[model samples]
Target: MDNIFKSAMRGALFFAAACLLLWGIVPEWKSVCAGLLLGAFASFMNALLLRRRVEIVGQAMANRGMRKMGLGLGSRIAMVLCVAMVAYKYPETFNLPATLAASMVMPFILLVSAFLHHKRH
Candidate 1:
């Protein structure tokens, strides 16, 4: 429950930051909302998958050797490749530029926030 709440909050924060930044640059409310929604969905999906992957890897690593860890990494790589292929095939629907921009913005804001939080602490 705590993990789920944390993930939701993180997604919301990323969505808000990307929307605010892009709104300042684009000056279009529709575009800003679109970007925010995209960012939030992407971040939430990524976080959920990442958390699951980490948990699986941790469990596997406890009983298995390093040689057996390739499956987890391979799955992640395959997932990335699949997403890339879909993006490539349906670029019009995907809106690669906006997607990439939102994707980059979320991580950038998260990193900056982490740095600031660390500095303050």
Candidate 2:
């Protein structure tokens, strides 16, 4: 799991940097690139939040502690909502559709990493 997370994080960061480069190189596509950058950042954060929550839950379960646990779905949703709101608020600065699409990139990266890890092991 940690390996998956680390690889995903690296991929996400690389993606975000690429988007930033594109934004600088193409002034006409600034909105799209900015939106993608924002979404990629949010996606990375969402993955980190989920990973931390999972670790906490695993620790609690191992210790036999009876505490309610959740995967922080609400927080992740809220984070996405905030991104959407930002895009909506500044349509010229960010493309809404691109932002939404980029927001899902991290999960795909993580999935690919998991598949590769499974095949290797």
Instruction: Point to the candidate with the largest lDDT.
Output: 2
Best by TM-score: 2
lDDT of 2 by residue, 54-99 (tens): 8888888999998666649999999999999999999999999999
| lDDT per residue as tens, model 1, 47-119 | 4566577777777789785633445546544544544455556654444455445444534545555665567
The per-residue C-alpha lDDT of model 2 at residue 68 equals 64
Query: Which residue segments of model 1 deviate by more than 4 Å?
Result: 1-8, 17-27, 65-96, 113-121
User: For each candidate, what is the lDDT?
Assistant: 0.54, 0.90
Model 1 pairs in collision: none
At residue 88, what lDDT does model 2 achieve? Answer: 95
| Each model's backbone clash number | 0, 0
